[model samples]
Target: MTEAATRRVPGAPCWVSLIVHGLSATQDFYSQLFGWEFRPGPEQLGPYVRALLHGKEVAGIGQLPPDRHLPIAWTTYFATKDADVTAEAIRSCGGTVAVGPIVAGSAGRMALASDPGGAVFGVWQAAEHLGTALAGTPGTPVWNELVTRETASVAKFYQAVFGFETEAVVSADFDYQTLHLRGRPVAALHGVGHGLPRDRGPHWMTYFQVADTDEAAARVTGLGGRVLHAPRDTPSGRLATVADPEGAVFTVVRPPED
Candidate 1:
C-alpha cells in the first residue's frame, strides 16, 4: 500500500463517504468485509468515523441527520482547489449545490452537488486532512464512476465544472467516457440509458479494492448485506455489486493482475 500524504490533483476523486441510518451496524458490516478499523473524526458532521487500513485513512461513514430524507448511498468527492468556486461553476453549468461550501472543522471545506443527470457528488477543498490517505491495497477505494442515464450533456457539465478532459470509448454498444486529469484517467462516466435503476437515480459508484471478488461477495451476504450482482469477470477485473444491510450500494473489484 502507498501513503497518500498530499492532496490529490484537482478534479480527481479524493474521497468517498456514506451516510446511513445505522452507524454502528454499518461500521460493523464494513469492518468485517474490509478489515477496516475505525477512528473518530470531523465531529462537526454529527456522528462520524473514518475508516483506516493499517493506520492510513481509507473512507468515512457517518450517521444521517434524522429528519433528512436522504438516500443511503456512497458519495464520491472530487478534489478541488476552492470549494466556493467549484460550487459556483456547478450552478452555472446547470447543476445544483444542495449543501454548503462549509468548513468541516479543520478537515476541509466541502459541498454536495448534483450533475445535470441528477448524479450526486462532492467537491472538497483539503486543509489538514488530505482525503483518502492510502491506496494500492485491498480494502481501500480504487475507483469512482458516475453511472447515469446519458453521458453527453452531463459529461460536458463535469468538463466545464472541473476542467476535465474526456476520452470516450469508441465502441457502438458501450456508452462510456473516461474523465482524465493531467492526461491520466481519474474517473469514468457510464451512460446506462434505459438500464439506469428506476429506484436509484443517477449516482456516483465507488469501487473498493479486494483480493478476491467472489469471496467478497459471499462475505457481503454472510454479513447481512445483499449481493446485487454476482462476481463476474470484466475487462478491468472481477467485480461484484453489493449493498450493505441498510442498502448503501458499492462495488468490490479484484483488478486484473499486472
Candidate 2:
C-alpha cells in the first residue's frame, strides 16, 4: 500500500478538483464508482464538496460559476510553499496567472495558471488544509501528466517555475518525460506533436487507480460515463481513458498484479 502524510513535497501534485455543473450528479457518479463520501466545505468556498475515502479527503468537487461557460475539467494542483511567489514565477516564466493567491478560508491560498501551451493547473500553499490525505490506492489519484505538443518549451517553463527536472523516457513512438522533484517522480509530460485531435487542446490529465481495468471501464459506462479508450495493457499497467457524464476526461488504471 502506498501512503503519504497530509503534508506533501513541494512541486508534487497534492490536490485535484473537478470544476463541473450539477454537483449532485457529479457526487453521485463518483460515489458509485469509488465508494467515496462527501463533506461540505466552508460555505464561503461556494458549492465545493470534499470527497472522502474511509474518512480521509481524496479529492474535491466544485461548481463552475454560472456566468462562465467553461468545459468541465479536473484541475491538478502542485504543492507550493508560497502561493504569491509561485504566481509571480509562473508569470515571469511565460505562463498566465488566471486567478488567486487568494485565501481559501483557513485552508490555504491558491492560484490558477495556464502554461504557454495552454494547459491549465493550480498551485496550493497549505495552511490548515493539507490537501489530499490519501493516495496511491484504489479510487485516489495516482498520477498527473501534461499532454501537449510543445515539449521543449513546456519543459523549460515548468523547470523555471518549479525546478522540475525532466528525465526523458526513451521511446520510439512517443516523446515522454518524467518531471521529478529533487529525485522523486512527481508528474509527466507527453508531446502529442501532430496527433492531437483538433477538438482537443493541451491539458493536464489526472489518473485514478482501480483493481480491475476491464471491470471498471464497464462500470463507468453503466454509470453514465463513457470509456473513450478500451482497456489496453502497457508496460506499467492496464489502463483506459474515460469521460464523466459532464465531459471531463481522466484515466483509470489497474496496475499489473504482483
Candidate 3:
C-alpha cells in the first residue's frame, strides 16, 4: 500500500463517496468485493459511513436523503485550499453550486457543484480529515475520469477554476484531455462525441485499484452488482466498469505490475 501521509495536493481528486438507498447492503457488497472495513459516522450526518482499507480511509457511503430525489451514484471531490473560494470560482466559471460551502462536522468544508457540462462533483477543504489515506494499491482509488459531450467547454471551465493544464491527446476517434497539476496527471476528461450509448450522460466515474480486474469483476456479479463493461486490457491496466446493485457506476482496474 502506498500511504499518503499528507493531504492531497490542491486540485487533485481527494475523496469519493457513494449515495445509496441501502447503506448496509452497500457496505456488505463492498466489504465482500474489496475487503473494506466500515466506521460509523456522526448521527447528525445521517447514515454516512467511511470505508477503510487496511486501517486507512479509502471512501465513504451515505444513505440518500428521503426529502430530495437523488440517484445512487458516487461523487468525487477534488482537494481545494478553500471551499468558499472554490465555490465562488465555480460560479464564476459557469457552474452551479448545488449544496454548500458548509462544514461537514470537524472533518472538512465541502461544496457540491455541477460543471458547465452538468457533471456533478465536490470540493473539499480538509481539516481533521485529510481525505483518502492511501492510493496506488488494491482497494484504493487510483484515478478519476469525467465523461461528457462538452469537451471543449468543460476543459475551459476546469482550467479557469482550477488552473489545470489541459493536455489534449491527439487521437482520431477519441477526444480526450488530461488535467495536470504542476505537470502531473490528476484526472482525465473523456469526450463522448459518439459511439457511446444514447442513454449515457455526463458524469464522473471513480476508479478503484484492484489486484485482478477479472476476479474483482466476477465478485461484482457474485455480489449482485452488474458489470457494464467486461475487463479489457489498456495501456494503463486491465479495467472494467461496474455498478452497484442500486446503479452507481464505478471502475475497477488492475494496474500493470511495477
Best by TM-score: 1
Order the candidate numbers by TM-score, best to worst.
1, 2, 3
Off by over 4 Å in 3: 196-200
Q: Quick one: best lDDT, which candidate?
A: 1
TM-score of 3: 0.96
* lDDT of model 3 at position 242: 96
Q: List, residue by residue over 1-258, the lDDT tens digit for candidate 1.
A: 787648789898999999999899999999999999999988898999999999999999999888877889999999999999999999999999999999999999999999888889998999998899999889999999999988988899999999899999998889999999899998999999999999998999999999999999999999999999899999989999999999989999999999
User: By summed lDDT, which 10 consecutive residues of candidate 3 come out lowest?
Assistant: 192-201
lDDT at 112 for candidate 3?
Answer: 89
Candidate 2 structure, TM-score to reference:
0.96
lDDT for each residue of candidate 2 in 1-258, tens digit (9 for 90 to 100):
555567887888899999788999999999989889999875656899999998888899998778978868899999999999999999998999999888989888899899998899999999998988887689999889898985778999999998899999787887899999889888999998987646668999999999888888998999999999999999769999999999899999987777
Q: lDDT of all predictions, in order shown? A: 0.93, 0.89, 0.89
Candidate 2, which segments miss by more than 4 Å at Cα? none
